[model samples]
Every structure is written in C-alpha cells, then in structure tokens.
Target: MEVYSEKQQIRAAIDALKSKNLTLGLVPTMGALHDGHLQLVKKALANNDKVVVSVFVNPTQFDNNEDLVKYPRTLEKDIALLKTVSRNDILVYTPTIEDIYEGNTVSENFDFDGLEFEMEGKFRHGHFDGVGTIVKRFFEIVKPHQAYFGEKDFQQLAIIKKLVEKHDIPITIVGCKIHREANGLAMSSRNTRLKPEYKKAAPFIFKTLKTAKELFGTKSANKIIEWVEKQFANHDLLELEYIIIADTETLKPVKRKSNQKSYRAFIAVYADDIRLIDNIALN
Candidate 1:
C-alpha cells in the first residue's frame, strides 16, 4: 500500500489508474482504524479494481471544538491496519487540513429535505453541514467510481445520498452494514476514548436496540422509546441522548408501523463523555 499526504500526488496517482481504465473505490475515514473501517476497505477491495482510503479527521465535521481536539489520530497505526486488509494496489490519502481546504474553506448548507431536522440533526447543530462540506470536498478530490460508508451512521448515509443526488455526482454511494464487536457494541473511533468501566457497559446500547426491534410490532414508537429509556435508567454511565423510531427514508419519527415502508430504531448515548450512536432495522 502506498500512502500520499499531498493532494496533487494522490490526484496524479488516481489519474494514472484512470488511464488504465481501472475502477476506483473509496472508503473515507477519520484515522484510528478499527475493525469497522477494515470491513469497508475489504468491501472496496472486493468490488473495485483499485481502492483509495482517505484518512483525514475533518475539523469541519466536529460541532464541538473540544471533540475535534479529542478525536483520535493514529496515522502510523492506521496505515498498519490498512496493510493487514490489503497487500494489493491500495492508496491511502492522508491530507493536511490546509491541503484539503486550500485557504477558501466554507461551510456547506444542504437541504436534506427535512432529513437533518431531528435526532442527530437536532442534537448536533450544523453537524451535517460540516459533514457535507468535508465529504463534498473528498468527492471532488478522490473522484472515485464508488464510495463506501457504514450504516452505523444511518442518517449521515441518508444525507450523503441526498448530497449526491443534489449535485448530480457520478459516484455510487454504497452503504455497508454496521460492524460491531463480539459483545454487539458498534465499533467507532471514539470507542477508544471510553473509560474502562464505560467500555464494558457500552454493549447496552445495542442490547436496547435489539429489545426495541423485538417490540416494534407490538408497541407504539413512544412506548418502545419509553421502554428503552427505562432499560438504561439503572445504568449511570450510559446516559441516553435520544431513542427514536423513524422512517428508513424520511427519518421523521414514526408513530406506527407501515406496511409499505421500513422503520429503524436510532439511538445516541453518552457513555460518560464519549458519545456513541447505533441503529437497528425494525421488522
């Protein structure tokens, strides 16, 4: 695997690949590579002729400056992890903030058709705008045939889809399944920040989602949310942010089951200061 921290060098490399008529797959990530990120890389390798994994902990995406400061950056370790996944022609684009922004940095205002008005959108103000800005820049730079993202950030996936459609970008946005630990906690870069005890209790988030899914057919959305709240009531370390049952496409809160549309349970919990998010499909 070859690593490039300069934008021009990476662009030239991608251009060389394009000359060979090779399809490029992209897995954009903020470093601190974990099993979850490896899953995306593996998928990219399986489908595309060549894969480019971009690792830049985008400062624009963080709503909290402290969260941005606290975000993990392990480029050396990340490169090592990428090497384990593929010994083939893989390019790791780790660009500097100045290289990506080029001094004319501006926040993106996206109309996600009300997709960003609740849950994560409501909680983290201008969070999706930051996400849109950075992702749009990556799309422009990488120009890959396809890009992969995990369904762990379901709403973010939806917003990216909207971004692609709105821009008429010719790239397939692939949403991979959420990769989880053996204990069922969704793997996240922020998981590294969790305290030892809070780490042990982290699986409770997924456990609650499982229970909420099981109750979907029999209980109303509000009731299921109430039940999830009560389940976490005894766990002092895991503070609930939001437990929402919403339409899979619209992301608006679902009042009842729909025969035509799918519903999903999305949850955000503050395990001490480390925020964790997870979602499960409701059948």
Candidate 2:
C-alpha cells in the first residue's frame, strides 16, 4: 500500500526488493482502475514474487486538448482498489512533468514510424510515440522481469511488444484477455463518459465483432467489410469510422488471401463523439 512520487524513492524501493532476490512484475496504468486493469494486476501477482502497479497518467498520449482535460483521474479511489487486493503490492512512483521531462535533454523518442500510423495510431497523430516514450521510461525505471498488458488495447500491446524486442530489453511481455461486461462491451475507463443510452448500445460493438467472426471465412474481405458496414449503418447512434478486415499479424488490409487463413476485423466508431474501438480474430 506504499505510494511514492519521487524517482529516488522508486530506485530505493526496487533496490531493496532486488536485494531479497524477488522476481518483479510491472503493470503500467493511467490512474483510473477498472476490472480490466485489475485483471492485469492479478496476472502480475500470479507470475512474480512481487508486483508493482504504476498509476501515472502519461501526458503525451492524448490527441485532443478536450480529451486530456476530460480524462478521468481518481488516484485515491484507484489506490484504495489496489490496496484492498493486497497490502504487499508494490506501487511505482509517479513523477510530475518537471520530474519526468526536465528539459530538452529527455531520452530520445521512439521512431514508431510504421507502428504509429496504423489502427488507432493513424487517427491519433504522435499517439504511439507518446505511448512508446513513456513505456520505455516506465520499463527503465521499474526494471521488471516481466510486464502485463490488456488485450483491450491490442494494437498498443503489439507496439509495446515490438518496442521491447527492438530495444532488446530483457523482459517478457504478456497480453491478457479483454475484460467485458455482461452485455459484452469491453471495459474501459472511457466508457464512463458515454451517455446513458449510448452506454447500453456500446455492447453492440462486441456484437458486431462477433458477427464478423461468424461471417469471416464465408466471404471475401470486401464482402465482409460490406456486410459489417451495413450492420453498423443500422444503428443511428453508432457512426462508423473504419471497418478493416486485414492480416492476422501484419495488420495490412487484405485484398486477397493466398494462404493466409487467419484474419482480424478491426473497427472504430463514434457514439455521440465518444470514440469506441474493437477488433476480433477470425480464421
């Protein structure tokens, strides 16, 4: 249940834990806790001798001023949720802007040219760079043997995996399952901002993804896209952003599959300006 706000304290804490030969696990978060985030913590707890959950709201990831201004911040409630799970949990230090980025001499930014321009990245300019920069910093500070991320952010998970591999950081990255509500909408902090009616309809995203899965191999990529598009068009509140049926791993839009049987259907939409994203695997 210990909370720290200084780098020196973080170093000392990790150093002390390392002295005891503990296998450390790091769960990086942005301060608002939900079932999805807790699943990550639970995984880290199971996999390591000690688990550290960081509650820093990284400033660099937001693409809009309004989004940043409106992003939820419930540090006390978040901390309480973590503490209730376990008092022995390691909470990482959260540095202020002055502490994190001191001057023009901050660590070099990730290139992220290819990674940043796909999926959510294409929509949010410099978003992956912000994700990459802070993730790199978090790993550098925590130095955990392993890290856990949610599948809800599948693309971000993919980018972070590539980041670790490219940098040769000695850590295992694990992607946990996406947590969902009874109605099937993926749990996210942003879900809080949705209007009451739109909140109820949010589960339709997952349902549409389910529909994509059911219709996957029966038709060509274009056919699948058309069918999904029509389904989305039926919902007046859900405005389709993009519906892409692409390669399972590469994420490139698939025109024709030669031997690639596996596919992923990624979609984005706005329900009264609250952007929602989701993807499903189909083979």
Candidate 3:
C-alpha cells in the first residue's frame, strides 16, 4: 500500500492508474480504522480495479471542538489495519488539514431538501454542512467512478445521495450494510473511547431498537417511543437522547401507520458521556 499526504501526489497517482484504463473506487473515512471501515474497503476492492482510502479527520465536520480534539488519530495503526484487510495494491490518502482547506474555509450551506431538519441535523448544528464541504472536496480531488459509505450513518448516507444529485456529480454512491459487533452494537470508531463498564452496556442501544421493531405493528409510534425511553430510564449508565419512528425516505417522524411507505426507528444515546447512534427498520 502506498500513502500520500499531499493531494497533488495522490491525484497524480490516480491519473497514472486511469491511464491504464483502471476504474477507481473511494472509501472516505476519519482515521481510527475499525472492522466497520475495513468492510467498506473490502467492498471497494471487490468492485473497482483500484481503491483509494482517505484517512483524514476533517475538522470542519465537528461542531464541538472537544469532540474534534478527542477524536482518535492513530494513523500508524490505521495504516497497519488497512494493510491487514487488503493485499491488493491500495492507495491511502492522508492529507493534512491545510492540504484540504488551503485558504479561508467557509462552510457551505447545503439544502438537503428537508432531510437535514430532524435527528442528527436537529441535534448537531451545521454538522452536515461540514460533512458536505469535505465530501465535495474529496469527490473533486479523487474523482472516483464509485464511492462506498457504510449504512451505519443512515441519515448521512441519505444526505450524501442528495449531495450527489444536487451537484450532478458523475459518480455512483453505494451504501453498504452496517457492520456490527457480535453483541449487536453497531461498530463505530467511537466505541474505542467508551469506558469498559459503559462498553458492556452499549449493546443495549441496539437491543432496545430490536424490541422497538418487534412492537411496531401492534403499538403506536408514541407508545413504542415511550417504551424505548422507559427501557433506558433506569439505566444510570445509559441516557436516551432521542428516539422516533419516521418514514425511511423523507425521514419525517411518523405518527401513524402508512400502508404506502416503510418506516424506521432512529435513535441516539449517550452511554456514559460517549454518544452513539443507531437505527432499525420498523416495517
């Protein structure tokens, strides 16, 4: 695997590959490599002739400075993990912040067509705008034929699909399945930061979602949400943030059963101060 910290060098390398008629795939990520991220790389390797994995902790995306500062950055270990996942020739782009945002970096406002108004968008202000800016930059720089993103960030995946359509970028956006631990917790880089005791209780987030799914057909959305909140209420280690049943497409909160469209349960929880998010289909 070859690693390039400069954009120009990576662009030149990709250009060289394109000269040989190779199709390129991109898997953009923040640097703390985990099994979830490797799954994305595995899919990219299977589909494209060449794959480029970007490992930059984008500062623009973080609304909280502390979260940004505390976000994991094990570049050496991350590269080592990537090496284990793919023996095929791979390019790792690890650009510096200045390399990505050379001059005045203004966060561009994105109209996600009402997709950004609830859940993550409502909670973290300007989070998706920052997501949009960096992703757009990467698309421009990498110019891959296909890009892979994990479904773990379900809402983000939807917004990115909108971003691609809004710009008319000539690339296919592929959403891969969410990778989870044996215990049912969605695999995330932030899982590494959880305290040992909190880690053990973390899987309850998914457990609760599963229960919510089972109760969907019989119970009202309000009733199901109430039960989910009550399940987390007594747990001192787990604090429920928000839980809602919403249409899968519009992401608008659903109050009643709809025969026309599918719905899902979206959730966010703070397990001992470490925030984790998960969602499950309720159809």
Candidate 3 C-alpha lDDT tens digits along 167-263: 9999999999889999999999999999999999999999999999999879999999999999999887999989988898999999778789999
Which has the higher lDDT value, candidate number 2 or candidate number 3?
Answer: 3
User: TM-score, each model?
Assistant: 0.98, 0.94, 0.98
lDDT of 2 by residue, 1-283 (tens): 7788877788799999999998999999887789888888888998898888887777788878688788889888888788767787667566776666665323356754366577787688778878888888888988999999987787888889989989999999999988988899988888989999999888889998897888765777888889889988889788899988867566678888656467778889898978888888777
Give, for candidate 2, the lowest lDDT window spanning 10 residues: 104-113
Error of 3 at 132 (Å): 0.4
TM-score of 3: 0.98
Residues 1-283, model 1: lDDT tens digits: 8899998999999999999999999999998999999999999989999999999988777788899899999999999998898867689999998898888665778887888887898999988988999888889999999999999999999999999998999999999999999999999999999889999999989988998888888889999988998988878789998899999989999976779999999999999899999999997
- Per-candidate Cα lDDT values, in order, are 0.91, 0.82, 0.91
Once fitted onto the true fold, the runs of candidate 1 whose alpha carbons sit more than 4 angstroms away are none
